[model samples]
Target: MQLFTGLALGSVFVLLAVGLSLIFGLLTVVNFAHGAFYMLGAYAGVFFIGYLGNFWLTLAVVPFAVGAVGLGVERWLVRPLYGRGIDYPLMLTFGLAYILVEVVRILFGAEGMPFDAPDALMGAVNIGVGYFPAYRLFVIAATAVLVIAIWLFLEKTSYGLVIRAGARDSEIVRVLGIDISQVWLLVFGLGTAVAGLAGVLSAPMRSVFPDMGTTVLVEAFVVTVVGGMGSLAGAVVAGLLVGIVVSMTSLFAPAMAEVSMFALMALVLLVRPQGLFGKKGLMG
Candidate 1:
């Protein structure tokens, strides 16, 4: 039961890290606003459910809403600044993240707000030694489905090939007559949608709070780094590994659970600065 719960919790990290990895992998956008996007998704889900009283609807709608916002950011904010140094994107996103969080605090208050679990998934299921929350199981299942789906999208599909090619060399892809600009928009939207999905999935598990994504963003970066930046498989493996480590360690040293990731990250960097499954020149 504990193991299952651990994996379930880690799955959220997997989802988040993938989006982060993708955004950075393709655009080198070091999106500090990533967490803000997640928080927005949760808040959007909360709002949707409150008005429509449908979890599934909110699940579908929240991602689209967030994705739309991402599209706008890509066009108006990120695109114009592309000619600038990477520092520009980093600083802009950091500022955006701060402003977004402050707006959330002002509108929603600093306290965590409640989000009801869908009645259909409100119980527990006995997995083996004990019972696990069915809702968490849904999170696990949903993420698994997403992983497989994304794997296919990136591995077996034409769009995925173009994205990968663009990741390798954006200028070359554009020279080859591909509209790399549209691809950038698509990838950014996809990343935001995934982050949004993470937020919606998280709402029932953790109350929606202004800073809910702050810690989560930091942890997602750790998971991405330990897995190897921009490596999807690495994200999945590291997410679960970190979750298990945190859970088991919290049993004895609760206060140290937070710092364990930093320690692990340092150890990993000493051995492999690029990450577990990262390619040799991906960051270059």
Candidate 2:
């Protein structure tokens, strides 16, 4: 049961870490506001459930809505700072995160609210070892599908080819007459959209609140780094690893649950600084 729980938790981390890794890998920008986008997804879920009243519909629509917001941010806020050094965009996103959190707090209030899972997903199911929440299994399956879709898109599609080429060398892509700008915008939007998806999925698992993204943001970063910076495969592997470690720790030592992943991260770094799947000389 604990292992299953860890896989579900790790699925969420994988979503966040992949988005973070994609943005940093391609755009060379550290998006501190990724967490804010995630929080928005949860809040959006709250509003959508009240209005639409359909979990599936909300899941489909929230990413586009949040991704649209991300598009606007990229075009208006982050675009102009592209060549001003990495610090400029990083600082901007850091402040943007604070602003987004405050905006949500002002509108939603500081108190946490319950987000119930759909009635169809409320029960437990037997999966060999024990009965586990049906919703958690759904999370695992959903993440797997999405991850596979992502891999296919990146590996087989023309747009994916362009994005991969851009990641390798944007200047060369531009020299080939491709509008790397549009690619960057798309990447940013896609990254934030994935973050929002994770947030919506997470809403039912815990209380929805303004500050909820903060902790997960930190954990996702650890997953990203421990998996090795800018490595999508690394993020996936490390996310599941960290999730299982944290969940198993909670089973035996509840007090150490939160910090266990961090300790794992430190150990991974000590032994393999490039992470499980990271390439050497990635960021110096």
Candidate 3:
């Protein structure tokens, strides 16, 4: 059951961490505010369900909303920073994160709010000899489905092929006479959409606080680093690994739970700095 629970939480990490990785992978953008975008998606879901009363609709609407936001941010905020020093994007995103968090805090208090499980997902199921929250199972299944879909998009679709080509060599992609800039915007939106989906999926598992993403950002970053900064598959494996490690360790030494992630990052960095599945010198 604990392992199941860990996997459940881990799925959220994978959903979000991969988005962080992909955007960074393609556009070389460090989007410190990506977690804030996740937080915004939860708030969007909270308000959306109020009007729509449809879990499925909220799931669909929230991602689109955040994706639109990402597009806007890229167009207005990040676009200017392009071709500049990396610090330009880093500083811009860091400021954006602070601004978003402050705005959320102003609108909602510091206390956490509850987000109910959808009626269809509000029960427990017996998995073998143990009982698991049906909502948790749903989370796991849904995350897996979304991941595979995105993977397929990245691997199969023409758009994905171009994005991959751009990732391999932006200069060559540019020489190919395709506007890789448009592809960059699309990938950024897709990455942001993933973060938004993670928020809605995580709403049932954790409190829907305005600042809820703050803590998650740290854990998600750990997953991103451990999985390799820009490697989607690495993030997935590292997410599950971190979840299981945290869960099992929490049973005996609670304080070490979060520490375990840092420990893993340190060990991985010492051994394979580029991360599993990551090309060498990627962080360069």
Candidate 4:
């Protein structure tokens, strides 16, 4: 059960980490505001679930809404910072994160909100060891499907090819007549949309609060570092590894569960330095 729970938790981390990886890979921007986008998604799910009266619809709508906001932020705020030093965008996103959190607090108050799973996903299922929440199993399965789809999209589509090429050399892509700027906007939006998706998926599992993003943001960073800064495969593998370590550690030592990920990260850095899947010279 603990292992299963860890995998489920890791799936959430994979969603957030992959989005972060995508943006960093394409734009070379460290978007601290990704977590804020996630928090907003959770809150949006609450509003949409009530308004639309369907969990599935909430899942579909909230990401697009948040992604649209991400597009504006990229167009006006992030796009302007391009060609400046990396620190400028990093600081901008950090400040944006704070601003988003404060705005949400003002609107929703400091209290944590409750989000419940739909009736269809409220129960548990037997799986050899014991019964586990059906929703968690759904999360695992859904994350796998989404990850596979993302992989296919990145591997098979023209846009995916552009994104891959852009990551390698945007100058050459531009010389080939591709509008790198528009791609940046789309990638940023897509990354934030992924974060929003993770947020809605996570809402029912935890309290929806302004500060909730802080912890997840930290974990996502750890995952990014451990997995490789811009490697989607690394993010997926490291997310599950970190999730399992944290979950299993809680069984024996609750105090150490939180620290286990950091410990593992330090170990990985000491050995690999560039991360398990991170390529040399890509450390930015």
Candidate 5:
């Protein structure tokens, strides 16, 4: 049962960390606003769920909505900082995160909002070993499907080829007459869209609040780092590993559950430094 829960938690991390990896791999921007976009997704889910009264529609619409916002953000804010060193965009996003949190507080109040799981997924089922929430199973299965879709999009499509090539050498791609700028915008939007999807999926499992993104952002960063910066496969592997470690540790020593992940990260860094699948020269 705990293992199942861990897998569910890992699914959320995979969703969040993959986006972070994608954005960093191509855009070269460590978007601190990712968590804020996640929060926006949750709040959007709340609004849409009430307005549309359909969880499925909310799930489909929220990602594109937040992704569109990401497009605007990339164009208006982050794009200007290109060629200005990574520090500028990093600092800008850090501030943008705070501003977004404050804006949410103003609109939704500081209180935590309750978001119940959809009626269809409200119960638990026996998975041979023990009972687990149906929604969690859905989370795991849904994440797997989304990850596969993303992989196919990147591996089998022309746009994906451009993105892969751009991540390797933007100058060379641009020299080939490709519009690297548009690709960057699309990558940013896609990354944030994934984050938004994660946020919506997580809403029913936790309280929806302005500061909700803070802790998850840290965890996602840890997943990104532990999996190797800018490595999509690394994010998927590390997210699941971290999720299981955190979950299992909680079963024995609750006080150390959070610390266990950091310890694992420290160990990995001390050994590989570049992470499990990361290449040399990838990390600063």
Candidate 6:
């Protein structure tokens, strides 16, 4: 049961980490506002659920809404900082994150909001060891499908080819007459959209609050570091590893749950600084 719980939590990390990795890989930007986008998605999900009365519709629509916001941010804010060194964009995103969180707090107040799982997902399922929340299993399955779809889109489509090539050499792609700027916008939007989707999926598992994204942001960073920065495969593997470690530790030593991930990160850095799937020299 504990292991299952860890996997479910790790699945959420996978969604967020992959989005971060993709944006870094393609746009060369460290999006500190990614978690803020996630929080917004959760709030959007709440609104959609209240208005539409359908969980599935909320899942499908909230991501695009957040993605649209990301598109505008990338076009207006991030685009200007293209050649002005990395610090500029990093600081911009960091400040944007704070602004987003504060705005949400002002709009919704500091108290966490309650969101219940759909009636269809409210019960527990017996899986030999014990009964577990069916909603968690649903999360695991849904995330798996989404991840697989993303992998296919990145592997089999012409757009994916362009994205891969652009990631490798945007200048060369531009020389080939591709509008690399548009690609950058799309990639940023896609990354934030994924983050939003993760937020919506995670809403029922915990209270929704303006500051909820902070801890998840920190954990996603650890996952990125452990999995190797800008490595999608690394993020997936490291997310599960970190999730299981934290969950198991909580059973034996609850106080060490958070520390264990950092300890593992430190150990991994000492032994294999490049991370589990990271390539040498690709710091981003």
Error of 5 at 243 (Å): 0.4
lDDT of 6 by residue, 193-231 (tens): 999999999999966999889899999989999999888
lDDT of 5 at 247: 96
Instruction: Quote each prediction's TM-score.
Output: 0.96, 0.98, 0.96, 0.98, 0.98, 0.98
List where candidate 1 sits over 4 angstroms from the true fold.
Answer: none
Question: What is the alpha-carbon lDDT of model 1 when measured against the actual structure?
Answer: 0.88
Report clash pairs, candidate 2: none
Candidate 6 residue 187 C-alpha distance from true site, Å: 0.6
Decide which is better by lDDT, 1 or 4: 4
* lDDT, candidate 1, 1-284, per-residue tens: 66786788798989899898888888888888899899999999988998889899889899899999899988898988886877888898888889989998888788888998899999998887888899999999999999889889999999999999998888999999999999999999999899999999988887898888898889889999999888889988998888877777677798997888788889888999888887776655
lDDT of each: 0.88, 0.91, 0.88, 0.92, 0.92, 0.91
Candidate 3 versus truth, CA RMSD in Å, comes to 1.3
Higher-scoring candidate on lDDT, 5 or 6: 5
Candidate 4: residue 64 lDDT (0-100) = 98
Candidate 4, poorest ten consecutive residues by summed lDDT = 275-284
- TM-score of candidate 3 to 2 decimals: 0.96
Candidate 2 at residue 101, lDDT? 95
Of candidate 6, the 10-residue stretch with the lowest lDDT total is 275-284
Q: Write the per-residue lDDT of candidate 3 for residues 1-284, one digit (tens) a residue.
A: 88998898889889889899989988888888888999988888888888899988999999999899999899889988888977899899888988988887788666777788899888899999698999999989988998899899999998899999998898998998999889989989989988988998898788698778888888888999889888889989999888888888798899898898899889998998888767887756
- Which 10-residue window of candidate 1 scores lowest in summed lDDT? 275-284
Model 5 alpha-carbon miss at residue 12, Å? 0.8
Give me the overall lDDT of model 6. Answer: 0.91
- Deviation (Å) of 178 in candidate 2: 0.7
Model 1, position 209: C-alpha lDDT score = 89
